[model samples]
Target: MLRRPQGNLSYVSGVTDDPLRFVTLSQALDETVAAHGTRAAAIFSSEREVMSWKELQRQSDDVAAALLGLGLQRGDRIGMCSANRREWLLAQFGAARIGAVLVNLNPAYRSTELEFALNKVRCRVLILARSTAAGNHLGMLRVLAPELDQPGAKPVLESRRLPHLRHVIVLGEGLVPARAERFSDFLRRGSANGKRRLAALAAALDPDDAVSLQFTGGTTGAPKAVALSHFSIVNNARFAARAMQVGEGDKLCIAGPLHQSLGLVLGVLTCVTTGATMVFPGPDFDPLRTLDAVSRHRCTVLHGGPALFQALLDHPELPEYDTSSLRTGIVAGAPCPADMLERAVQLLCLDELTVVYGMTEAGPVTFQTDVDDPLELRVATVGRVHPNIEVKIVDPDDRIVPVGRLGELCVRGYSVMRGYWEDAKRTRDAFDETGWMRTGDLATLDADGYCRIVGRVRDRVLRGNRLVCPEAVEALIRRHPKVQDAQVFGVPEVKPEGRSDAKPEGNRGEDLCAWIVLAPGAAASAEEIRAFCRAKGEAEQVPGPVRFVAAFPVTASGKAQKFAMRASMVREMKAREIKTA
Candidate 1:
C-alpha cells in the first residue's frame, strides 16, 4: 500500500542525477570526492600508518593509476579478499574511482567460496589480506593461488596460480611471496611520495557504468554475483544519511563487516559523504575490542548487526566498559529482541536506534524505523521507505494487494540494483517484467503507511492447501519473557512409514521448527512454551515446537541461515524415526 506522502521526490537531497535516466555508483563517488576535497577526508586507525584525507586521496589515486597502468579496462573485474583494515577501504574506493568493477571478497570465505566468486567474475587483479588473530586469510589465499594463477588453463600469458589473476596485492606487514606483489610495492611503483596522475583516472564516469560486483550470499547454495552501478550504492548512501540525519563531525563506530552491503554503505560510505569520522576495530570485529574503540573514540553512533550487539550485551564483563558515548545508529541482521532494544536505550544510553530492512542488491533500503519510535513499534516494524524509493505489495495475479494485507514486497527506485553481473537471466528473474525488484518478503503496510514484516515469502510452508508464514512463530516466540531471540522455518512433511503405509502422520501437512536462544540463567521447557503459544493462538496459525540452541548458525551479514537449520532438523527427524521401536 503506497502512502500519500507529505513530500515526494523534492524531499530527497543530492539525488538530482540526469533527469533523462538513472546514474551509476561511480558517477556519485566522483562527484562526492570532488565536492569534499580528497585531501580533506581521513580514515583513523591504531596502526603506524594513520592516513590523512590527502594521503588517502593520493593513495587511491596512485592505486587507481597502478590498476590502470596494468591495462585493466573499465569492465575488468578486481577481486579483493581482505578484512576490515584501512587498506581494504582504500582498494575498494580506489577501484570504484577508477571505473573498474570492485568485487568485495569475503575474508571468511574459504578457498572454495573464493574460487567460485573469482572464476565467476573473471577477476583480473586479486587483493589478499594477511592472516589476523580472528582468522587465517593469507594462508587460505595461498592455497587457492594455484587454481587462480597456474598457467595454460586460460588464454593469458603463461601458467600461473589463479590463471585469471594477473596481479595479486597483499595488504599486510609481511614479505610478499614470489607469486604476489605487496600493496606498498605497487603504490611505490605507481607514484613517488604524494604525487598522483589523477587526470586520466578521474575522467567523469557515467552513472550507469558497472562499478562493483558484490556477491549475494544465497540462502541455498553458492553465492551469486550482485552488480551495483555507482548510482545504486551512492544514492543509497545519500538517502540513508538523510534518513539517519547524519551530520558533519559525527563520530561513527562500525561493528558490522565492511564486506557486506549494510556495512559498505552505512559503515563506510556514509562517513565519507557526511564528513563523519569512522573508527573501525581491526580486521575482524572483536566484541571486547569494539567496546574499547567506543570508549576511546567517545563514539556518537554505533551501526551494528544484532549479533554484535547481542554478544556485547552477553559479555560477562559488560559493566566494566564505558559505553556512555553511543547515541544513534542502525541495529539489524538478526531480529533485535525487544529486550535488546531496551537494554541498548537504557544501558548503552543511545539516543536513537533504527532497524534497517534490505539486502545487498537493493542496498540498505526499503524500510527504516524512526529513531524516536516506541520500543514495541520499533521491534515490530522496519518503518517506512525513503522518499526516492518506491515500494508496493503485490498478489499472485500481479495486482497490488489491499492495505493491511500480506503480499510480496517489491521495490522500484534509484536504490534498486542494475542487474547481476554477467548473469542476465538471474537479473531478469530477480525483477518483474515491469522492472520492480521482487523482494521475496511477505509484509503488510499499515494504515499509517509503516510496514510490518510478516515473514520471508521464500521461507513459507504449504500447509494443507494454504500458505503458513513461519514469521508468525518468530513473533509469537519473541513475546515470551525468557526467549531472547527466535528464528522459525518449516520442515516439509515426510510420508512416515513410506508413501504406501497410509494416514500421512496426522494430516496437518507441514510442521514448524523454531530455534530459540534463552535469556541467561532462564529455563523453560517445550511444553510450557507450547502452552504460551496455545494461549495466543489464532485460527490457521501453525505454531511449532521450540528447539533451544546455544547459538544459531549465521552468515557473514549476521542473518540466521534457516535453510541449514531446516536440513539439520530433517536429519535429526530421520534419525529419531530409525531409533524408535
Candidate 2:
C-alpha cells in the first residue's frame, strides 16, 4: 500500500528515477520499427488488416508525403471523422510524421459540431469515412457545406461555413465530392520529391511542437480544443507502459475509439513506445468481439471503461471465450464500482487490472493504480501520483488543503497540455500563477498518498445551505445488489401556483433526487431503494425522491450525463405533479 508522503506538504511529485524518451511521435515510430521490424504493429480484426512495424512505417510515410503533395504545410490542422479503423491509425501517425496537427473529430458529431470543430481549428484538410452505421458522415458534411457537393468552375470548394477547409479526403468507396479525393488516389498522388520533403520535415520537428488537437468532451459546455505535444504524450505513454509493465510482443486489445486520449495516447502510442502489438476488435466496442479477440490473439492486455467490463461480464457467452491471456489492462474513463472490478478480475482472468484517472487536458493520465498494488487500493482509490507529475489538493481559495481533506485536484507536470487551442482567455482561467492546472474535480488525498475523486466541482448539491455530494449517495446505492447504476442530484423545490408561501412544505430549498438502473431480471421500487439507502446511510445521505430509470444519457465515452438526467427528471416531476419529501 502507498504510505504517507515523504514531505510535510500536501503536494506530491512522482519519483522520476526512470529515464523517459523525449521524442516526437514520428521518431518514436521509426525507433520502434528499427527495434521490432517484422513485429505485428496493428491488427484490425473485423477488416482483416494487419500491418507489421515496417509496413506501418512505410505506409505512414506514404500518407505523410501525400499530405505534403496536396499543399498541406507543417503545423496545419487536418481533421478526421471516422470510427476506429485502419485508416484512422494511418491518418493519426501520418499527420504527426509531417508535423501537421491531426484534429480528431468525434464520429458521433453531426454537421454543426463538425463545422465548428473544423473552423475552430482552421483545418485545411478533412479525412472522413463515407458512411457508418451510426449515420452517413459524408451526407452530413454535404449538408453542412454544400459547396463541396456542387461542381465549381475550377473543381474547388469555398464554403462560408468552413473558410479554412480546402480538401475532403474520403476513406471508403463512395461518390467523390467535387472538392474530395478518393483515399487510394490521395495516396497515389505523392511523389518521390514529396517523400524527400517529408523526411526533411520530420528531421526538423521538435518534441515540444503541438502535434495533435483533441477536443474536450464538452459535457459541461462547449468543447475546447486542447493542444498536446509530442513531448507530453510520448513520455506519458512510456511511463504508462512502465506502470502496466507492457512489453514487446504483448497483444493489446483496443476497444475504445482512437480519437480520445485513452485510445490514441494510452492504447496506441503506449504500444508503439513499448513495442506491443495493438489489436482492434472492430469499428465499435462489442463485448463478444472483444472477448473473441482476446482469446484468438492471446492478447495480454485490454483497455476499456467500467461499462464495457459490465457488458462483458453480463454477456451470456462470457464463459465461452478463454480470457486467460488477459493478464492486465485499464478500466478507466468512468467510475469503476468495487463490485464491477471484482467481477472483472474473477471472470475475465485479469489479475492485474488498473484504474486510471485523468482528463483530456492532462495528457489523459496523471494517476493510475500499479499492477502490484493491493486490490483494495486499486478499487477504492485512483492510486498515487504518476511519475514526473506533481499533484496537490487546494480549497476554493486556492490554498493547499490538509491531507484527507476534500478539495479541487490540481496537477502540474510535463504532461500538462500547453493550453486550450487558440483561446487565451480560457487558457488563462485554466491555470494559476504557478502553472498548476485546476482539474475542476473534487478529490481527497489520503494519508497514504492515494487519492479518491469524489465528484465534479459543479456536481455539488446544495441542500438546506449544506453542500451535498451526490457521488457519496450514489456509491451507497450502487452497493445494492439489485442496482445496476445510480445517480443522485439536487432538485430545486418547486412551489405550487397561488401558494405565495415562503417555501414548499418539507423543502429545505432543495431535495435530493435519485435515478437508478436496475440490474437485469432484478426489480426494485423507489420505496425499497430508499429503505436500502436508509439502512446503509445516514439521514443526510438518503435521497428524498428516488426514481427508477432504465438508462442514462451518456457521452460517446460512456460518461453519465448528470446534467441531462437532471433536466429530464425536472420535466418528469412537473408533468406528473410528483411531490418531494
Candidate 3:
C-alpha cells in the first residue's frame, strides 16, 4: 500500500537499472502479435463481434493490403470514424502496419463537421462505421462525399472516391450508391499474409517517425494537428500500464470516446497490449447502461471523464447495479472533485481512482496518487510523473520553479508528441529550443513530486470532464452565416465543487463560455445555439453564453482578448442567478 508522505519513499523499485531500448508502437504490436497469435484479442458487446489476436492480425493485414492496393503510399493520411467496433481496431492497426498515418475522427462528427478535418489532414482513405445507436454513419459519409475537393484540387486521396478522396471503406453497414466498398469486402479481396512485408515496414519506422495525426484545440479557431509516432505512443502506454498495473483478467470499462487520447492510447490500446478486456458503452453513453454493463460484465477498471462520474452517481438506477467489481481506474481528461474521489472509495467501492494529468501532445506523463495513497491527495492532485516520465515546473522565463511554485508543466519523455503534422511553425512554437514539450498547464510539484494542476495557460477550456476543443467550437461558430468572429473558453466550472473559481484566460483551468460577433445582421438565441450543439442527446463541446459582440477586443496580432469575455461571463452568471433568484 502507498503510505502517507512521511518522507520521500524510494521510487527506485519500479525502474530498471539496465539500459532499455524504446520500442516503436508498430514493433510493440508486432511483438505482441507474434507472441500471442491466437489469443482472444478483443470483445465488443453481446450480439456484437469479437476479434481474436489471430483474427485481428489477419483482418488488419487484409485491411493493410487493401489500402496498399489502393496505391496508398507510406506516410499517407488515412482518417477513420467509428464507434467502438472490431473494425476500428483493424483500421488503426492496418494503417499503422503499412506505415500509413492514422487520423481518428470522432464518430459524432457529421459529414459537414468532418470536412474540415478531412481537408486539413489531406486524407487519402476514410474507413467509417455504417451505423450505431446514435445515427446512420453511411448517411453522414454520403453527406460528406460531395464536399470533397474537385479534380485537381488539393488534399488528394487513394481511390479517388470523392474527386479528392481516394477511397472510402465502410466498416459496418456500408454506404451504397456512393460506390464505397465494404470493409469486409475490401479485406477479403486482399492477401491476408503480409507478415514479412509488415515487418519490413515496421523496421523502417524509427522512434521519431510521425505515425498519427491527432488534432488538439489550437489558438482561436485553428485546429493543431499533433503528430505522434510509434515510439512516443508505445513507450508512454508501457509506462502508464505499469503505473496502473493493468494486466490480464482485468476488464476495463471505458466511457471516454475511443477516438480521443484517453480512449485511444490510455483506453483502447493500453488495454489491448496489456491483455485486458476493454468494454465500451453502447451508443448514447447513458450512465445506467454503463453501470449495467459494469454489473453484468463485472468490469474491474473504469476510465471516464469527470462528467461521467457525476452522471453515474446522480443516476437514479445507480443503486440497482452491482459495481463491486470496480477497484482502480482513472479520471484522466479533467481534474476531479475531492468529494467525488471520496465517494468513489467509500460509496462506490473503487479501490482507488487515479487523477491522470497529460495531453494529446504528451501523455501518461504524470500519474499522481497511486492506488494506496490517501484520499485527499488522490482527489486533489494529478500525482507524480510515471516511472519513466520526467516533469519539471517551469516559469514563464523557462526556468524551473521551486517545489509548490506553480508554473507551466514541461515534460521530456516518451509521452511527448513528435510534432504538429506538416506545420513546422506550430510545432516550433509548441516546444522551447530544448526538447521539453511545454504542456501549457499551470501546475506545481510538491516535494514528493505530486503534480497539482492549478489551471491552463491557453485559451482553451477544460469543461466538466472533457477538453472542450474551443478551436473547433469557434470554427464551427465562425462558419455560421451570421457569425463573423468568435473566441471560446470554459466558464465558471460547475465541476469539482472546491475548484469553482474560473480563470478565463491562460490554461489549466475553467469551464467554457464563448464570445461571438454577428455577421452584418445575423443574430442568434441561446436555444438556437444549444440546438446546434445537441447531437444524439450527448453534448460534445457545447457552447455556453453566446456573448454577442460588436467586435472582439484584440491584441497587436489581432488575437481575441479572451479576458474581456471572461469578465463578461462572471457578470452574466451573477446577473442570471440574481434574476432567477
Instruction: State which candidate has the highest lDDT.
Output: 2
Residue ranges of candidate 3 with Cα displaced over 4 Å = 1-21, 34-38, 110-112, 131-137, 147-164, 192-196, 458-581
Reference-based lDDT, each prediction: 0.71, 0.86, 0.68
lDDT of 2 by residue, 120-205 (tens): 98999999888875688888988888888777654356888889888888987756888777899899878999988887899899
lDDT of 2 at 65: 89
Estimate, for each residue in 1-581, the C-alpha lDDT of model 3 and write its tens digit. Answer: 22122243212112333223466665666666677666656656543656666787777777777777677768898987777666777788888877898997776654545777788778878887777655786776666564332344333333323445667677654333335666766665455455456667767766667777877643344566788877777766666666677886788887667677777787767765677777766644678778887888788888877677878887778888889989888786665766677777665678777778878888444554577777778876877666555567777788776766767777776667878777898888888787877777777666666767776677556655655557557656665666666777767643222344544334434555768777786778755665665641237557756667788765322335566667767887767655654
Residue 350 of model 2, lDDT score = 86
Q: Which digits, one per residue and each the tens of the lDDT, describe model 1 over residues 32-127?
A: 556655433433444523454556665676777777666766778998777677777777777876678888877777667777888888888888
Worst 10 residues of 2 by lDDT: 1-10
* Count of residue pairs whose backbone atoms collide, per candidate: 21, 0, 24
lDDT of 2: 0.86
